[model samples]
Target: MEDQVELKRVFGDVYFRARRDQNTSIVYAHWYGSQAVETVKAGGYKFLEMIKEKPYRKLLNSNEHVIGSWDLALEWAQNEWAPQMRKAGLRYLAYVVPTTIYASMTMEMLIQRIDDEFEIRNKEADAEAWLLR
Candidate 1:
């Protein structure tokens, strides 16, 4: 994050924090733990609102520390968030999948179903590289 500029961290009901990297014009969200779909949506909507503060085109979302099944969020992610984000000028998304098996499966399914542009990576550095590239 050496070259990155920060937006004040935003928190939500779910275990996650979001900030903007002005250098890359990307919204970076780090999600943790298992959460109810409603809580997840709360955080997701917060993320969407953050991007609206600026015309960012890329997102680097890391699920590396996640352990809970968020399978329920898949539908909203694909149907609601993806479409809304695309309409908001988001052109690229670099999703860092969780290392834990169950969470990874859910996230993989989510990335698979999302209609908008996305590139999945195993690590944040890889995701950043992909986003920056």
Candidate 2:
């Protein structure tokens, strides 16, 4: 199937895009500023809504551009979002880790708690390769 850009949602400092290609759906996130709890929750809602509409086994989540720690958001994601997303047919999530130590740490923590296949890479290309594989 041809790649189609499905849901594109922006809330505060975060931008979410879901694009479908064949059996894969890439969920891209470009975030600015600190990821507040409300903004993170809104973004998570949009993400879940889009993924449920089109079940995708593969996902690429780019977070390299995020500048600050989203520790609280990470907790919410691990406890709330991850389980729901996994149930929505998300099998593998390839993530491009952020540059800051705190952001990276939070991402690591979230990754550890999730049951689905999760990979963290330093580059977007690497993340995409993992997702495609």
Instruction: Using lDDT, give the best candidate's number.
Output: 1
Q: After superposition, how far is residue 7 of candidate 1 from its true place, in Å?
A: 14
1-133, model 2: which lDDT tens digit per residue? Answer: 2233333236433244445665445655455445667767776776677678867776676666666777777777887898888888777777778788887887778777774534444455677777766
Error of 1 at 65 (Å): 0.7
Per-residue C-alpha lDDT of model 1 across residues 63-117, encoded as one tens digit per residue: 8878878888888988899888878878788878888888989887887787445
Q: 14 in model 2: Cα distance from truth in Å?
A: 5.4
Candidate 1: residue 46 lDDT (0-100): 75
Q: Name the top TM-score candidate.
A: 1
| Candidates' C-alpha lDDT | 0.74, 0.65
TM-score of each: 0.82, 0.75
* lDDT for model 2: 0.65
lDDT of 1: 0.74
How big is the positional error of residue 115 in model 1, measured in Å on the Cα after superposition? 4.3
